[model samples]
Target: MVAVRRGDVVVANLDPTIGVEIKKTRPVIVVSNDSINQLSQLVVVVPLTKNIAHLSPSHALIPKGVARLTFASKAVTEQIKAVDKRRLVKRLGILPPALLTQVERALKNTLAFP
Candidate 1:
């Protein structure tokens, strides 16, 4: 299995949903600590959306083509989740450290964690 490290933009299978589901196989950023990611069967991730409306600290916009992405996307901190590593389809690219730090901050704010 490929190692999933923090900051990796990965494709995942996110189907079989319930209400307000993010749905479908999509791009997600691995937000878990690298140590835990190496040892656990599941990895934490934040989903991305193309929607740019109502941007806030909780929603950091990733510039177009960052990590070779085709379009700009917003990291939906509100939609953070964890899933089996098997759900990861492919690693797209690593997000730059500085932006990832912004994501971590947003995650903290969204989750109300200290």
Candidate 2:
């Protein structure tokens, strides 16, 4: 039996003494949108922390730090779109050149942003 059911949000608890860390359980949701499909698929959001180890190869890495963002989900794209719309409205009164440059850089590095 699973202690946590659907729609439950969890967090990670790091324990160095035991060399064990508690991690958040990804949430799964079943969407029934006719536009998508008739069958419901499980959408999971796996939260991850920024890997400081990847920043440098020689440095001693610690996994004690939690992720800056609270949750990671398929909803990220929508969230990003919403944020961008707000940014466009609030800053520059148009799509800022700096924002576009950052987005281009992100695409060059990861091929995806959001």
Q: Estimate each model's TM-score.
A: 0.93, 0.18
Question: Model 2 misses residue 73 by how many Å?
Answer: 14
Q: Model 2: which residue pairs collide?
A: none
> What residue runs in model 2 are displaced by over 4 Å at the alpha carbon?
1-23, 26-41, 44-46, 55-114
Residue 64 displacement in candidate 1 (angstroms): 1.2
lDDT of each residue in 18-50, candidate 1, tens digit only: 899787888889999999899999999998888
CA lDDT, candidate 1, residue 8: 93
Compared with the true structure, all predictions reach lDDT values of 0.87, 0.23
lDDT of 2 by residue, 7-105 (tens): 222232212222333222222121112332222232222222334334321122212211222322221111111011111111101113443243234
Model 2 collision count: 0
* Model 2: per-residue Cα lDDT at residue 6: 22
- With a 3 Å backbone cut-off (N, CA, C), the pairs that clash in candidate 1 are none
